[model samples]
Target: MKTIVFKALPFDKTLLTLALESGVDAVLTSADKVEAVRALGRVRVLTPEELPSLALDSKTDEEEAVRRLKAGEQLALAKGWEIIPVENILAQVPDVALEVESLDRARLAAGILERGADVLVVLPEAAKELKAIVREVKLSQGTIPLVPAVVTEIRHAGLGHRVCVDTISMLKRGQGMLVGDSSAFTFLVHAETESNPYVAARPFRVNAGAVHAYCSLPGDKTCYLEELSAGRDVLVVDASGETSIATVGRLKVEVRPMLLITAKAGERTGHVFLQNAETIRLTKPGGEPVSVVTLREGDEVLVRTDEAGRHFGMRIREDIKEG
Candidate 1:
């Protein structure tokens, strides 16, 4: 995850509050103000004196920055630092924090080397842009390529435990969770972002899947629905495969009628057991969601393909298979 550090220098209470509300990872302020910042919220507070400073004005300065980074000290690059030196330092060390004075610079710093810097120090002058920066750099989880798969089978699975993931974030129409029996071929299960006559919209929830199923998570990790709990992070993907992190506010596991959905994308085939209800939906190739109850054989839906191997929820290379 990318870190967003707010430069709360000169003790601006509003800026500190903004940082706290924006979910910034840390606040850089004077030593005396650290406690006050903590009083506002739980975040890392860094004093200028505690961080090794670097001004990449010359070859010697760049070397010092690289040396300090190698020595395990998190060096904060001074503003006006050139991209080449930052890139050079990033190539050698992954913990270097770049001080960005504007949203543009923050975007540039994040896109460096295509992996971005480990941390960004948003200067006080850019406080107004802090929210935007945090949203773009911190909330965005990039994208995944989604493909159309043909539904090969649908069976009425016996009543079993189903997990309804209630997230703290309100989801949009195209947003949902990816879940399946195997992590290698999870289906895009749409969220309850649509309102019907029988039930009002519960935009914060996704009637995900069976307790034993794999739900796609951030950093390419997967966790079983039974393993999810309040405060855990889950990756929410849209029809276009754009992803963002959502905090799990609650998990509802109940005995509900389930349907076994099997789909095939190319030669790969996989299945997921989901609640058999009209509100439970799988996303179609064009982004519209089709209810699980209405899902039929030959219907095309979006599914993600991957290597079908997981050990303790983490992807691993081994001779492993799952039905």
Candidate 2:
């Protein structure tokens, strides 16, 4: 994940306050204004003396930047830097920082060479779109490649312990967690963001599935639903595969009738045991939540499939199989 640092030098009070309120990772301010920023809010403050900004104009400057980085200098590439030069530096250096004045440049910096810069130094002039930039870079873990998997079967699985994940952040209709019997083929279990005559919308909850199901987490990891607890972070994904991090407020486990859902993506087949209730839903292709009771065989729904090998939730290279 890229940490965003807002440049607040030649300090403007409004910009500094906005950065703090917008959840900036750190504030880059002057030595004199360090205390001022600290007084305003609690944030990691960086001074020019500690973290210097460099402009890459010529070959010598690039070399100097690399040399300084090798010598353990905290640095950032100033704005107006070309892509080739950044790629050259990035090829040699890992986790370099870059200054971006807008959301577009920030996106470019974050996607440079696929594994882009680690830190985005947000310029002060970008105050208006600061929240959007931060959300897209920090929260939206880019986009995950989603595919439509045809439902092959759905059957009653009798009574079982189910888990309802209540996150601190409210979710939208198409957003939920990805979980399944295997990490390789996870279903887009729709959040409780839709309402019915019998139940109010639970925008903060996802009636996830069976307690033993595999739930996706950040950093490409998966964990059983039973392992989740309050304050832990989970990956909240949308039907379109855009992801955001949500903190678990609490876990609600109860005895509920379960339904086993089986679907196939390519040659890979996967399953998820969700609660057999009309309120429990899965996402459709067009970003709508369709109830499991209404979901029939041959109905297409969105799912995510990856190479399936996990050891203690971390991905590994091994021939592992799950139903």
Candidate 3:
């Protein structure tokens, strides 16, 4: 999770609003203007006096900055700090905020040491370029390859605990979450984003799966459905495997009649436990949502296959097996 901080110095109302609309994590403004920014939106507003600053003017200054960072202080580097010094400081500190005057510098600072700076302070004049920086640094988590899988079997699994993930953002018809019984193979469980004769459209919900299933989240991690909560971020993926970030607005867990669905993609097999209801659906390869009740053997659906191993919800390399 790369953090974007907008430098709204001198209290420009338009730039403050742009920061909020761009989804920046915080705004760097004056102490007196904090309330004004908050009145417009909900975000972290910090004044220059509230945070410590370090000027990397020389070797001794750089050493002092490293010491301050080692002492556990969140320090922001003054603008015009050279890349070499910035790289050296980043190599020693994990949470240094770099000040950039333009979009090119932001990109360079983000790519420094390959891990990049912990935070970027974009000048207020660069508000127009903030959108691209945020999208690139935050939403670009790479792509997942989705393949067509044939449904091998579907059977009633009796009553089980299911999870309904209500997100802060409205999803589209071809969007949903990736979940599975195992980390190696996961299915694209479609969101209830379409209306039916009996139920109105719930474009903000994806009745994810059973409590024990693995759901793909941001930062290349997986978590059980039971671990989700309000304010937490999750990855919402589309049929083409393009992904964006969504915050959890609420989570609903209850016992419901479930169906055990199994499918085979290439030589690998995978399954997911979904609530047995007419609204529960899995996405087909063509981006169509098919109800689980109507899903039959030989039906083709989309799935993602990967090396099957996870340790503490993060993918790891090991000789392990999962059924």
Candidate 4:
């Protein structure tokens, strides 16, 4: 459905493959020859300048720069890909510390939609507000994935003011998992933390029937980093109740909109407070008042979150779309 173009040196074989396998629609450039573009689609251009380099090149910085660019052009020609001269996309960067109050997050989100940014990154402190803004953007505009940052340190114990973190142990080690139920509903959660106390604990079984949608990440990737890079709005649920749904943490993400939403048993309780990068709403259907921003009567909303752990919800106003 999408096409990705790369401008890497011939030597950057690893980078090319990484892009292709990692959900890139197509791989172009980074080869010895260049080609033409056909049917302009979602194009992702990766450059070596943005990525860190190893100690293989010459000590001189100039030599390395020239070598990388030349290799990039060669790779482009070999792959029959278009070479975009300008660079607008960036990767694996730190969170930008912009005040959401100072600028209308909704307005900025609109601009991001216009600019066609692959992802929108917001500070953890302003994640809740950003989630609301993102929801607005998606409702008005098309689906633009949002990745919110959790700009804080990780604490080992006590569950003090921490975002729900996904771990590899949960995913692979059999403690927990990022799985969907037989109905094909998915969620990101810890087995011990979110599971139903009534059921007998299984090795890899996740109690998805209790929760609507959940996801889980490995230990190496923290909650903050996951949400920002994740392509959708992230939902942050506070089991500790130490932090309000409004308060922002490190990273937050919303799941993709295409995914289905099924009702779970426990998501509607007063204890289950959720803040999506797109909107603050409980994951349950026909919910009580936890003050969640939901689509009321034909209102459209945009929801975005990737495997990273970030999410966004956008409420689409029909009036605006009609105008």
Candidate 5:
């Protein structure tokens, strides 16, 4: 959830169109050109009065920046400002904006305090690297630590409700959703990106697991499979733990024979009940899919472990346990 704004002041139509095509969150333009910018695309257009730009060179200026931010105002910092003053303002609030003239400066602004600034104003001079700036700074996410877990048990769980997650974005072979009975330990369920003799490949779908299981989402949140619906965002994680956000296009819930898979990793045991079929798969250690039907007790697969407490999809601090 990072906000990227392209500064279109002085109103260059080419750069405005480029910003729109680059998927910028907002376009900062003059009041006279707001209508023209809106006519081009459906983007948030801001005038100078709406999001004023300033420079923080002295203590008084830094105090003014801090005061404006504390008063619930969002302003942009001019380029050539020092990092210490920005950090001082950021320590108190998280909504301070920074103007950058290059992709490197944008990355630096985004990595401030390890959480980045709430808003990034892109100058028109950086038009050549706008797409790269958005891709690397906005769409990219953090990585998680994935470990090998040995399969302990695989049993027929009989006819049960399962969920199929259909995302708007096409997923690759090693990317899928992480689901399990416990958030602390979850299995990397592979997407249906492989074509078999019987069925065609579904690069947009993941036969995730049972409807009651917990599936990881962005911002370190989790939700049950049954609760996922169209227009919702789910976290798509690869075997290496790199993550991205995918919008749900549809959800399929059906009664299919399920297999309860149990795996153990360093004394921690986790379970994920998935549909019993050849197409249903889990990711292997080398970033390949291993079908559930072909899985054996000794096989090793990729699994993720994290802090377990969650209430209503948000992480919490409490003494709670799940099987």
Candidate 6:
């Protein structure tokens, strides 16, 4: 079993699911506890003091600092986690002149790399500089994973959307990497691509697809469905919360503000088709009969079902309805 290092527990269920699917062998514990080793299967725990080459700068908003630390702890709890003591990790790192700006981050990151740091932590503000250092190490024919410390917020829990995008971007560096965050699970549902060339080092797979997808079609991503035609897979996701429908298959594509439904028309009457001059409806317990609207000659409607409940007919209206 290969060893994988992490600075925090994977709080985001999506990323956690992806990591499990991708075959990561172990998680670096925050406590550096022996029990974590047994729990993670193939594991080796390291303390932060073990590395001497790296340093950490404690400069940031108090709220952000606490947020990042909590995220790390949450990651540990999700996986068999232990602490990587700062003292131990830094001791083994080959000491270098500390830069005034990122003196601490450089030391910590460099120390971990020298001491086999599979996943090194960096402050969010230092993310750009961390990337630069990773590049330098790669130039020397070295490969190491530099994990960023992201400060999460209630508005954007689980590191929200940006972190996943960042992880995908870093995978292009071709190094064994892991992201430790409380919110890593958020994007797991919607991030669908496995083994993306963008980040080939660690091809992580999450159970969920990313709410946002890379659109091959032109124009702003928000307008992807505006000009598209119907009867194809128009993937739509909920960027709002955990409870909402994460992804819904848009059945058809027509003129602006119009749609066609293609999935199951109803649960009792699986796969009903509707093509009318104006509107269509489905008959289901507690379900609104009129499922679609604005149907001209060649329009379609799709319905989907989930564990929560059954959904009927797709909305093909041209006008945006008020919330």
Q: Which candidate tops TM-score?
A: 1
lDDT of 6 by residue, 1-323 (tens): 01233332323334333333333343333454546444534444444333212223332322332344444421111111112543342343332122212424443434443443333332223333533443332112222111111112111113212111212221111111111111111111223222334443222211111122121111101212122233322222212111110122232322222122222222211121122212122212221122233222222222222111111212233333210
* Collision pairs in model 2: none
lDDT agreement with native, every candidate: 0.90, 0.92, 0.88, 0.26, 0.91, 0.25
Please list all clashing residue pairs in model 5, or write none if there are none. Answer: none
Error of 2 at 222 (Å): 1.6
* Model 4 Cα lDDT, one tens digit per residue, 65-161: 3455445422111111111211111111111111122125424423432442232222233333433443343322232222111111111121112
Q: What are the TM-scores, per candidate, against the unseen true structure? A: 0.96, 0.95, 0.82, 0.22, 0.96, 0.18
Candidate 2 local lDDT, 115-216, one digit each (tens): 889999999878888999988888877678889999999999999999999999989889999989888899999999988999999999999999999999
Once fitted onto the true fold, the runs of candidate 1 whose alpha carbons sit more than 4 angstroms away are none
| Candidate 2 lDDT trough over 10 residues, lowest sum | 134-143
- CA deviation > 4 Å runs, candidate 4: 1-6, 20-26, 30-116, 119-189, 192-205, 210-323
- Per-residue lDDT value at 2 in model 6: 10
Candidate 6 whole-model C-alpha lDDT, 0 to 1: 0.25
**Candidate 5, superposed: residue stretches over 4 Å from native:** none
Clashing residue pairs in all predictions, respectively, total 0, 0, 0, 62, 0, 69
Model 3's alpha-carbon lDDT is 0.88
Q: Please rank every candidate by TM-score, starting with the best.
A: 1, 5, 2, 3, 4, 6
